[model samples]
Target: MQYIRNFCIIAHIDHGKSTLADRLLERTQTIHSRDRKNQLLDDMELERERGITIKSHAIQMEYKYKGVSYILNLIDTPGHVDFSYEVSRSIYACEGALLVVDAVKSIQAQTVSNLFLAIDRNLTIIPILNKIDLPVANKEKVTYEIMYLIGCTSEEVIYSSAKEGRGIDKILEAIICKIHPPKGNLKAPLQALIFDSFYNTFRGVEAYFKVINGQIRKGDKIKFMSSGKMYTAEEIGNLRLKHISKSIIRSGDVGYIISGIKDTLSIKVGDSFTSVNRPAKAIIAGFKKVNPMVFAGLYPEKTEDYDNLRVSIEKLHLNDASLTFFPESSIFLGSGFRCGFLGMLHLEIIQERLEREYGISVITTIPNVSYKVFLKCSPTDIFLVDNPSDMPDIFNIERLEEPYIKASIITQVNYVGAIMSLCIKKRGMIKNQYYLMPQRVELIFEMPLSEIIFNFYDRLKTISKGYASFDYSPLDYRFSDIVLVKILINHQLVDALSTLEHRSNAFYIGKKMCKKLQKIIPRQQFDISIQATIENKIIARETIKAVRKDVTAKCYGGDISRKRKLLLKQKKGKKKCSLLVK
Candidate 1:
């Protein structure tokens, strides 16, 4: 245990985090020559195509220091703000973290966000300035920024290029000397904390855990403390680049375990594993429940395939525990699942995986945030609503509250005005602003999660020319005046197109939605009356003209009386259609 070190690498997106992990693997020869590839830990197809890490990956390495063999467990974490939950889980499992910053870009929003998480856990911090070999690299400036953020001295910061594999040996030596190893009792009742897990077809669920107290061995009866389900350990081993099975995993070491548990919902992440023969008295603490920020509906393209979609999502949820979903139905889209996600990117990734990986054709509705409604009949009881169609009647409602967020944005000083304008347009209120550097500034805002869940990120990047970085944390819900906007086609309500928006912007958005639908909806035999309504009052309307058939076109040579008769017949048909619309 004294010779073992566990650490994780964290930074902002595209800030050389994955590159640093690649370099470390090469330095320790933990990965083989044939297996060496770019972003090695990001094994998913979507991750490679998008050039991002959506999940955290763990691997074990053996390093020799001063003729003594030392075991190192390294977890590579994602840098995006939407996946910060992954960073938090990884931080709790490790003893130290390498704070990687790009020499060219310096410290951004996510960099500061992840640093706080590691500090809150009291983990050892090793600051490294990466991308130093680039021609545009500003090594001294980035080093000063890291020192300011971490309160570390100049000599404490390491300058290196991850792409070029410089300063790898120094990083290893620092880990051995600076970071402490795991401390546990090998003779105590076995208590292992499961940090990550994924489903497999043949072997069942493969869970990666860290033994805290006693040893866990192959064929030992293991049970999850939360679920109280027991199973014999089919396999146990260290998590190298490849699976290396062993008979036993001792205390204070990281390893993987495979039991015959086939049910996807049976194994929950953060659950503790204990020996059935000598069970632990209590479960582990410090595991936080996930709080989703955005809510959306996912319906199958065909209603008959709903069961298949549910199964696919169940299997996928085992891999991504952050995703939460519940059954929901809409008059417009039929049966579907109302899903909650950390952010828009997380939602998009899940949608793509359902189509590409699971072969489930899906229809995604507009994303919204959860709300709390207090009714007149039950003022004390809070009614939670995520879908707009689920909102209570206007006369039955008492008070409404919507989720808000404390957003922190980092960008150049010149684009501050543009950013502030964009946020304000989305009903964001400015909170605090400060200068991180002479040219770089950080702005804080209090805004609705619903406002930013759609296009705030895209608009912010466009306004700042991709120089701005945004990160946010949930703030308590506040009093909000919002209305439900419902869309109707030919007097029939389309629940899928309904939305909840602030009363101030309700009319504008309603009109905009009507106009947008006019262009997309195809014309029919009768005129399509697209109307946006609020509380049974029509606020905006658009008309799509029907394709009329000229009944007298072939009667050009006929008598005047016959032509008049045809015209009168067509007029009567128009009146009948109008009466039916009413």
Candidate 2:
């Protein structure tokens, strides 16, 4: 245990965390040079295409320095805020972290967020400045920023170019010297913390855990602290980019246990595991339950694929504990499931996986944040609504509270004015602002989660010329004057088009929605009216004119009485059609 080192890499998206991990693996010869690939830790194709890590991966490595053999366990984590919960779990399982920052772009929002998480866990941090080989790299400025953020001296920071495999040996030496090994009691009863898990067809649920006390071996009976169910360990192994069987995983070691349990729900991330026969007196302190922040309804494009969609979602949830879903039905879109996600990126990734991996195309409604509604008659009577279609009648509600978030944006100085203006339009209240350096600034705001769910990120990228990065955390719900805006097509309500917006911007939002709908809905035999309404009042209206055919053109040489009679018949038919629409 004294020669074992457990550490994880944390940084912002596109900051080269995976590249650094690959270099370390190469330096340690854990993976052969002939089988090298870009972003080896990011196994998913979507992750490579998007240039970001989605899932956390752990690998065990053997390194020899100064004729001393050591065991190094490294975990590579996602850098996006949507997967911060996953990063937190990875951090809790490690003894230290490597803080990677870009030499050109300096520190980003997620970089700061991850640093805070590492500090909160009381883990040792090793700061590394990457991408120093770039032509535009600003090493001095970036080193200063890292020093300011982490309170470290210039000599303490390591410089490297991960793409070119520079300074990898120095990083390995630092890890061996700086990072402390895991320490636990070997005489106590068995206790382990399950950080992650995935399903396997051949064996069952494979649980990735760190032994906190005692030891685990094959044929040992273990019980989950939360589920209170017992299962025999079919296998015990360590990860070397692949599962390698081991006879025993002693205390202060990380390994996987193949418990002969078919149900994936029985094994949860952040659950504790202990010996069934000689149980530990107390379970290890695990992380809090993960709660999804964004909600949306996913419907199959074809009704016959409903069962396929359900199966696909179940398979997805087995690997991802942050995702939640339940059965939901819509009058316009048919039967579907109401799904919850960590954020917008999580929702997009799930949708893409369902289509690509499961071969099931789906239609997704507008995404929304959960809202708390209080009844007028009883102040204590409160309920949560995840879908606008399930919202209560407008007349029965007393007050509405929506979720808010504390957002941090880091960008160049020139784009500060534009970002501030955009935040004001989105009803964001500025909380603080300071200069990270003379050329860069950090702006903090408290805004509604619903406001940024649709187009805030895209607009921020556009206005900032793709140099700005953002991170946010959920704040408590606050009472606001919010209303549900409904869209009507020829006097019939379309529940899929409904949205919740602040009362002050109802007119502007409604007008824009009506104009957009007018262009999408096709013309019919009768004039179709698109109306945006709040309660009983219509705020915006657009009319799609009926298809006009010249009936009088065919009767050019006819009598005047004949033409008049034909025109009278057409007018009567038009009046009847209009009455039917009303």
Query: In angstroms, how far off is 290's CA in candidate 2?
Result: 2.0
Highest-TM-score candidate: 1
- The stretch of ten residues in a row with the least summed lDDT in candidate 1 is 573-582
lDDT of 1 at 24: 88
Q: What lDDT tens digits, residue by residue, belong to model 1 across residues 1-582?
A: 898999999999998888888988988988789888999999999999999999999999889989998999999999899999889888878999999999998899999999999999889999998888999998888788788889999899988888899988889998999889988998999999988888888988899999999998899998899999999999999999888999999988999989877888999888998999999998988886789988899999999999989988887787887899989998768898999899999999999999988888899887889999999998999978998889989999998999989999999999999999999988899999988788889999999888998778999999999999999999998999989999998898889989999999889989999999999999765688999999899999999997678888888585699988988898788778877876
Q: Each candidate: what lDDT? A: 0.90, 0.90
Model 2 poorest 10 in a row by lDDT: 281-290
Kindly give the number of clashing pairs for every candidate: 0, 0
- Residue pairs of candidate 2 with colliding backbone atoms: none
lDDT of 2 by residue, 28-109 (tens): 8889877789999888889899989998999999999899999999999999888888898899899899999999889999
Task: State the displacement of the C-alpha of residue 191, model 2, in Å, after optimal TM-score superposition.
Answer: 1.6
